[model samples]
Target: MQQRAAITLALASLLAIGLSGCGASEAVETSPTSTSGQGSTTYPLTIDNCGTQTVVTAPPQRVVSLDQDSTEILLSLGLADHLVGTASWTDPVLDSLAAANSGVPRLSDNAPSYEVVLGTDPDFVTASFGRHFAQGGVASRERFAETGIGSYLSPTDCDNGISINGGGTRTHALTIDALYEEITELGAIFDVPDRAATLIDGLKTRAAAATEGVDFAGATVAFWFADTKTPYMAGGLSAAGLLAKTVDLDNVFSSSPEDWPATTWEAVADRDPHVLVLGDLQRDRFPGDRLDDKISFLESDPLTQTIDAVRNKRYIVLHGAELNPSIRFVDGLEKIQSWLREHKDEL
Candidate 1:
């Protein structure tokens, strides 16, 4: 707790120094339009983000995205040209964004050192998870602020008690609203509100279409992110929970508050989920990070082989990014919905 307080104090001090002479910039009133005639974002735009006041003097020209989700969000906004560096990928880039992502320099497949990140000379930085800003990951948001670099952390991770060693817990269930807010805020920061709006609308429309008439009232499911021995199961307040709730599927481990809680195979078998949603991560950080490994373990293990999901091979594979709160979360929802449609009769 003392460490956390010190970090907070440092952040406040740095923010104060950064904003020493800057009073609130004039607010520009414009119609909330998503296209032309939408007035440009006024300079010295100040955003109260995750309890930190982020001041953007101008649209970030050289930005460093510290996570895959944030990188994808920027790419979707047509701001790929503004990206100076990107890092921490869990899966392959989305097919549609591959061309643009290929152009951005990859700092690392995981978190890059603070100095390495600074070497890119980025005017702004962004991350989808709070862990990336923790001490051991890259650098604290305060550190970036001290260097005159504006930063944004996804609202989904805000106040979630995240640390370098854990994924954190969520007291309330996550929805697409947080993700939408991130996109909209990033748009405002980049002076591309229209792109953000269009992206949000499209996502909402897709989510609506996916959930239309879809009801799986009593069906039970489990999301396994990684770790073969003590599987990390999704709790109720995560992106996985959002997908389950969207289609009315009950998450077997929904009672847990931790975003990803490690559970014994015996415990998982006790619930005996009707379906298993496995994360197909490209990163090999853990034993079960790969799809084949997860499947092989489920089918071969004595404790899990008898489980209903394993017995029936009712498995749904999702990219690692899809399991996290981001634009691809909508993709995960659609895929799960599609799977249910195909197997509803079995249920």
Candidate 2:
């Protein structure tokens, strides 16, 4: 499963406040903002840090997006007018995400420096990558405040500072509920509470629809990512777990102690799942001839042929974005719905 720490507006009940400094409440606005729309509720949003509140009279006008996924959400919400810039630490914008990305200032070739962030005169800086904070000096919470720029961490990237056994790190330790929570939070923060509620409700409905009549007590599957020479395993509480629940399939990797831990082929052989979710392949990572040389390696891996998922062809190849938990998460549920329907006969 994919996760983000790109600090897209974070929405958690923080146990310990980060470096966000305090801003005294402004003299009360004689007339508080009316947040209602046709009987809908309006909340007086207080963007705070450590018990203090910062209210904006209108929607943000100068937003600097630090993570691509967060940028995607802003675009999805039709909030590009607020964008002053966008940046990413990983690959550049995929074609689907390019329309919104064009012409916007690039903060960095790979994560623009805080000075660059300041230069944009951004009102809001979106990012939650732990490295941005945990490994300080690059762009600490202090930097955002010093520049009068508000910083938002991705609430989904909750791994705050937790470490995993494998090489890679995981986020907020992962939970389906967390995914829904993030969407709802984004909705409220962006003043599109209705859309957030609608999207989340649709996901729950679709996931339930996919698993309605099936049983999975006897079946064991792998939330498999057969890429990068090793088998990446997804733990329960991850997007894959949510995916498994959607289809009433058991993910053999459900027992992983850490979320999204790297499991070896030997481990896969030991559990030998009946199904495989294999999207994050090398071919998928590269669009054209960029990574073609590794095609033979992927095909020749011993795990390729011996896994039951391969022989029985119970593999599920998902779109790259599907693996991540975001508003796009609903898109993932849709894909799963279609895939399960296409293979419902097997179940």
Candidate 3:
């Protein structure tokens, strides 16, 4: 009787083990889930990606750019067709880009929240600024990875050091040349390399002509920006410096410790420049009011009246997209050179 009972118990144990194995096998057989957009073959949009290795096939159809520069970059690339949504940072310029894409719907009134991004059902997201990837912000690279969405960073401010956004910051030694090269690279990604090459070469030619100097090889210029409230001026290594180089003006701020450095009114008194490039005009003043008001301010301001630029009326006011880092920067250079030419007799 005992032997029979033991035999039945052994058989029961084996049966239980077999049933557990079947359950484990069923779990293993369940199909893995994936992000929605990859069902269709994701077409290759070859990306130069700033300095990153070329991406052969980047799946970025419904793109959401986080900042104004990123939005403008995308617009310039002629990839507006793939843009699903964008932010308010595009401001006054992209009204036309927006009108054309109005039917596509907005991702956010501001930099997008994660919820808004998810609801849009995006395949990929790209941004000019990295703030979107900060703690709790939408489209953080790590979080996007979880959902199998890709992200691309614009060369303007990679890895988020000291970023001068509206005001351009010079990163590489060959800042202007680098920008042109990157433009060509972008064209390749869009399958419009010829168009990109044409644009770059044309801009380079224009920039070269603008900088073809009468003289400034020995003279320094005060590349002033912003108001006296914050006292922001560009250094020799800043975007202002690059602009100065284009016009062949020596940068007075080369010794400045910071890119946008604050100096005492005394400092301006000390390193007074031959020309004053007032790149930052009064925000409320229209472009037309600039020359007159700047002339008046230079004459009236006790500190400015003694400066060579002020005495000679060599103050130049750069406006619109010219002041921004968009391709129009060369146009700003051309305008500055024109001002210098107009005042050549006095200098």
Choose the strongest candidate by TM-score: 1
> Candidate 2 at residue 193, lDDT?
48
Residues 251-309 of candidate 3 have per-residue lDDT tens digits of 88777634557765567757888877775443432322244555565588798688877
Report lDDT (Cα) of residue 340, candidate 1.
78
For residues 178-226, what per-residue lDDT tens digits would candidate 2 score against the true structure?
A: 5565545555555654454554555566555545555544567776544
Residue 338 error for model 1, in Å? Answer: 1.9
What's the lDDT for all of these models? 0.78, 0.54, 0.54
Model 1 lDDT, full chain set: 0.78
**Best-to-worst ranking by TM-score:** 1, 2, 3
Q: Which 10 residues in a row give candidate 1 its minimum summed lDDT?
A: 18-27
Query: Using Cα atoms with residue i matched to residue i, what is each candidate's TM-score against the true structure?
Result: 0.87, 0.68, 0.64
Q: Model 3's lDDT to the true fold?
A: 0.54
Residues 27-74 of candidate 1: C-alpha lDDT, one tens digit per residue: 122233232223456545667666666666667778999999999888
- List the pairs of residues colliding in candidate 3: none
Clashing pairs in 1: none
Q: Among these predicted structures, which one has the highest lDDT?
A: 1
Error of 2 at 33 (Å): 14
Error of 2 at 318 (Å): 1.0
